[model samples]
Target chain A: MMSANTDFTLAVEELTVSFDGFKAVDNLNFYLDKNELHVVIGPNGAGKTTVLDLICGKTKSTSGSIKFMNKELTKLSEHEIVRAGVGRKFQTPSIYENLTVFENLEVSYPRGRGVFGSLMFKRDAEVENKILEIAKEIMLDHMLETEAALLSHGQKQWLEIGMLLIQDPQLLMLDEPVAGMSVKEREQTAELLNKISAGRSVLVIEHDMEFVAQIAHKVTVLHQGKILASGDMDTVQKDPKVIEVYLGH
Target chain B: MSFMYEKLLGGKNGTVGFVLLATLILVVFPLALDGFRLNLVAKYLTYAFPAISLVLLWGYGGTLSLGQGIFFGLGGYGMAMFLKLEASSPENTAIQSTPGIPDFMDWNQLTALPWFWEPFNSFTFTLLAILIIPSVFAYLIGVAMFKRRVGGVYFAIITQVVSLILTVLIVGQQGYTGGINGITDLRTLHGWDITSDFAKNLFYFITCFLLLAVILMSRFILTSKFGRLLLAMRDKEDRVRFSGYDVANFKIFIFCFSAMISAIGGAMFTLSVGFMSPSFVGIVPSIEMVIFAAVGGRLSLIGAVYGCLLINFGKTAFSESFPELWLFLMGGLFIAVVMFFPNGLAGLWEDHSHHIKKRLGFITSLFSKNDTAAVAPKLEGSN
Candidate 1:
């Protein structure tokens, strides 16, 4: 793992998001270092997902400045954020269920995500080969031709991860990555995250303590739209406030 | 084999088969049917145009527009005005003095044609009016509605009001619009004798080819990324907006395209029926177009064509047999289709055939394997 004192990859300053006169995320501030696997855990309605939404440009921050690699992210659209190397996976698998696994990965490629790209059937062999290679690395080669809907819940989640990997984003924000996954699948996901964290900055939103411990190098606990605590897993887990909110005190 | 059968039955091939069947029936009907039936079929083809537009807007674009009839009316009026001007008296001096010039003008005691109606005297001007007026109206309404993010049921209601307003305006304009009776007695189009069989046949062919072209164009759009984006918009509009697409622009484009298509259908209908009237472009007819699309299969392009033919044919048959219960029958059909087959008839076929073959193959294989096992046991025991 990279040293703990490395330069920040993502920096947020006083981010707030409001909807219909009600604030969802309020005056949040955080910084994620390069090659760090960070976890954001909180109770329901704690603005964890909303923070990710702001970062991914799904929801514009009411008032804030988000800088990624010293570039302002507030003005960028979702596709622009994606092009700038930020990948996000929704709580539910947001893949094309009718398409084959390989086709799903192929569709996630930056070029294929646009209007003209979807119409034309032209194939970039290098991209295809890379996708195939990634699918193989994720042990999805056998299921490459299978429709995404037919895959098990665990496989679908993995396929979504593989899709994000193909985009080759500099930062990945995964929401509840292991919500419905089996124990074995959870371990595999943890291992996958560990493998990818070597070169990329990962912000994982997970509730499972064991899964977070296995992969997260640093953790931030959010409660009611504010950060309650932030530190390494052991430090955050021992915090009385973190325990009372996340786990029964 | 069963798997292959399932693939063939459930896949795009089924859609192709349906399209091919429709083309065959349309091509052969004129040859076998008498002139009256041929004319009715031609009328159905023209009606199919508006339905086709609805399919693109509602079925594919996911915007349920109820004001398509307004565009249709505009096109019809445009053509009617030009044709009436052409058939007017040669001595231009009488054009201003005659109060009973077009009967409606006499009823209202009007002195001269409306200024707006003057330009429509030329065929070229009328044709341009047919395309431009409806498109501009749709574009303006679409921009306003979409910019405000007013969609779904709100959009439907607004469009309904638009059609209602248009119908009332046309009906109240007794002097120029021919009042509730609307402008009729369209004897000729660009000097072609519309009453002649050759002209009718020529128009019928034109309608058929145009319908085919629209269907192909819609299919192309549906298969493209824009189509997928539209579907995404339908599935989740906010997600699409967040995905960096200009949702309002897409909506406006589709609305304009739909209006243009509906206008073409309207022009064809006027030419074929030899009249343009308020009744044909009223609120009821607008709703009927929605029913045509809904009954056929909203998502299927072929379904739109099928729906138009089926409903029109059923209407003709029922009205002739029992006019009072015709509405009841249509209502019942819609209710039954909606309650039982949510995906419509096309969806029903897609779901059934694949599973049926798989079950049949499984049963046959099971019995054959059991017989083989029984013979093997008997042979082993005998040995």
Candidate 2:
């Protein structure tokens, strides 16, 4: 099973992490194929975020391997993981508040990752054009000059998505991309996620099942650091175990 | 008008501040004050370097270093060592048992020049050391601390301890380091009499030029993508790291850069004041340097200079008469700045500059009203 598999973009095999004695993400085997929009839904303490954390190198796994494009991710640092074509958006809208919307997207551009490279990084046409395109995609083109701090809750959320979009990652992981957004904003975000997940793999941790049904190509219901159900949205929704542990709420 | 702003890294207000600072330091200060007072102002300007460096390190980078005096002392001591070596020429020190070593070394019974001091005999080496040594030291410290993710108040406390340790080391080693009194009587630079009023004025211009050049260089950095990243890292370290930026690298770079800037100021302080003492390299001076940044508006580079000037002038004036009250006053001023004027003088200026500009524009418009003869707003348009 561990034989170099190029079929999947991300393959997490026997991934287990424990904080002292408590296992946060227990021996989990997860696979994400190219262009698949996968959603991980779980109740509180189910270690939904812990899985994302382990995959993204934010938290080190006690044992097991996470391979992205067959590259070992467990040993790589967080920034190195990001540079390896993986982008993770936090549960909250994390953005540079002092900077304008244009700057927010511009800062996320993939070029000039080195120390001096960033110092000499110019806002040339290629960069400007890319920022403009991503800004439009995220519906932030009109508010490009606005300070991120002044943006509405939903706009800030979109702004963060746009930041990740600017990186053009092969794998995008968002934790509750529409947690605090309005319903209308949620619908728009669902639309945005579906549209952007065409070429790259998208892994999302969300609780909104209706919103999940709208976007998930595949769904995995996590229960106490273990996958209780995994399949298409409809099948997972109908599963008795998923219903008892998660949907029953 | 905005197009012109685009040409300069800081845009309109930044360029204006740069020019205003230049004029004040290079022109107004020299012409307004006598040579003696001008020399004192130059000495004050040396302190401004560390303050300005703090603006970048603390204000933008979000790393508060309480031991800037370490780098400042390094630069000062580097310069002092060279001057002491020069002053201790065989002819100048013929009375000592050892004719060529420093007076402190002779007093402490040193027979030969220490290996470290031998390199300082070369002027080029001394200048390079002044620029490089502090940055290297900071780089090592930055790596040790930042890589380990030791920051916030703990990082600050560690730096304070480092500065305290340095001060103790310098004072204890009376033979090698000039001790608590510091290296003194720097007579000349390249055989020219630096102690004279003529040299004082000359060094003043040189310091001003160096200060302005560095400010421009910093402005360039502050306007770059790196600058934006600094703000990003400050706000969200994890976000920046996930954004593919090695957060520690940026912190280390800024830390090292700020140290180099502080060292330049230290070297200048030694040159202008003709002394490098342990008193200037300890926790008190380090904290005072931080206060200078705070008072000037840590976020504003030029404000840092003004902060240094304002606080130092306050220090000199209040301390002269009510010597005991100076510390209390300084503490009061810091608290006031933090409470009310958190942005410092620069933020205050930034907050009100627009209103002032509008009022000035109104005054100018009043005077020019008769010349343009422009019509008032059209009230006749159909609503």
Candidate 3:
């Protein structure tokens, strides 16, 4: 028990990634407790998304380790890490444009992931009902038959979140889930995020302070690949270093 | 019921397209063309196998391979090797210095049969080799490229390079491969005289039936969950990867599956055409095979078959009188398909289908109203 941080859903320690003599993420230590909705806010080029990429195994670290569920994630492949119950949403809306909303959700249903498994996968009532449940949860039930290409910008964002939600990942890392959303859409998204984070660890990288204050249980401000200030939203906002680097701008 | 129909066959429209192609090949071509011409069509249909495969790999899987001819040639050469060996019995080759070996090996001054060629003597081995050999080759290439994340045009160029290497290997090793002339003088398959007109006709029907089955198999893949995943991976590879899929595995499976399909066509090509040459195993034929897929409708499997039939018929027709201009025309057709008709022939059909239905009001009345309503929005959405 002393060897592992079982209380934390994710414990990233001494993580560093260097490219061409420049360390993009430099020995950063971050931790998330169970059911904690932690937000990472930083200016552009602050290695915010890089941290997400590192945790999800999209980008390999030069040193240090990322432990999730007492399992070292840095050594696993991207899909292997994902299969271990960690879902990541990109900053941009990355839903499949050519697929229908139903198909887009169905592809992420977390079953039949292997090549042969997918070929033999039958769409039973369980799958159908699950897709329907997620679609409705994401507020895209009416657009199930509609192609994702026709969805609005906000709807596309929700659909991307829906894609991650269907996986039922233990740790959900979202990169700016409301970047292009309208006020109404953002409100719905905040509510959706709140509902989903009830029993799971949620890590978000957001720029919008209002949305951050809306959904964040705790906030961590990153500056140049290192944590500058980490605490509740009020504490992060009041930190002189955070105001100087990010919030002031 | 409509969903069920769509599930089995692509949609109601696809069912029509399948039947239409079926009638054109099975019923119409045999009734219309003579034996010699029909055999020519059979040769053209072999190219359709690669074209149909491209629709699955390039169109749906979104991996453009310009070296399908390599797999086709592998299949052709495998069959040709067996046939050449069978034709080179001690009794037939008693005149040669070395009997019981391929004549080319004898001409090149080889005394014994190569160890590798021994297994090919069995017909069972040749049949299995047609499916397994190319799949293994494709699997190797798929792992080398897809695992390393080398895709799009880079992947295309590597496949072309593979075809070139295969061609050089075949032409360079004259004795074992029969060199540039290819392993010719093929006479029989399992003691049946394949050179006979009856055999040619039987082979034609076999080609058509085999092609239909291939199309159905490809459709089954496309409609399955794996099919949707392929399309998703094509559009958003990162998303698919993050969605808990080993994306490389999917690409490898499709590539191997696509290679096997092309190899089947290649084997048929040897049977129908009586020879496998380096000319058909190089970069040129490989790219030409892609043109067939592009012109047919890269997205539509049935369209790929028609594309092959149409382009190959044109190649045979124009090359006879204006051989010098045919290459230019082929090049021009590929450019035109890429520049303008990105989706190819079937795309045109889908785009204007509603209009065509409306124009023929009397005929369209026979179709269900719900079908038209169902497909109308799809047009505007895809484009």
Query: A178, model 1: CA deviation in Å?
Result: 1.0
TM-scores for all predictions: 0.84, 0.95, 0.95
Off by over 4 Å in 3: A1-5, B1-8, B358-383
lDDT of 2 by residue, B42-157 (tens): 88899888898889999999999999999999999999999999999999999999999999899999999999899999999999999999999999999999998899999899
Candidates sorted on TM-score, descending: 3, 2, 1
After superposition, candidate 2 runs with Cα above 4 Å error: B1-9, B357-383
Tens-place lDDT digits, model 3, residues B243-299: 999999999999999999999999999999998999988999999889999999999
Worst 10 residues of 1 chain B by lDDT: B2-11
Query: Candidate 3 has what TM-score?
Result: 0.95
Best DockQ goes to which candidate?
A: 3
| DockQ versus reference, model 1 | 0.29
In candidate 3, the second chain superimposes onto the true chain B with a TM-score of 0.92
Q: Per-residue alpha-carbon lDDT of model 3 for A1-249, expressed as tens digits? A: 124646789998888999888888988888899999999999998899999999999999999989998899999999999999999999899989999999999999999999999988889999999999999999999999999999999999999999999999999999999998899999999999999998899999999999999999999988888889999999999999999998887
Give residue B347's error in model 1 in angstroms.
3.1
lDDT (Cα atoms) of all candidates against the true structure: 0.78, 0.90, 0.92
The digit string of per-residue lDDT tens for model 2 on A1-249 reads 565767899999998999998998899999999999999999999999999999899999999989999999999999999999999999999999999999999899999999999988988999999999999999999999999999999999999999999999999999999998999999999999999999999999999989999999999999989999999998998999989988988
lDDT of 1 by residue, B104-149 (tens): 5655777667788788777788888898999999999999998778
* Candidate numbers sorted by lDDT from highest down: 3, 2, 1
Instruction: For candidate 1, give the docking quality class from DockQ.
Output: acceptable
Docking class of 2: high
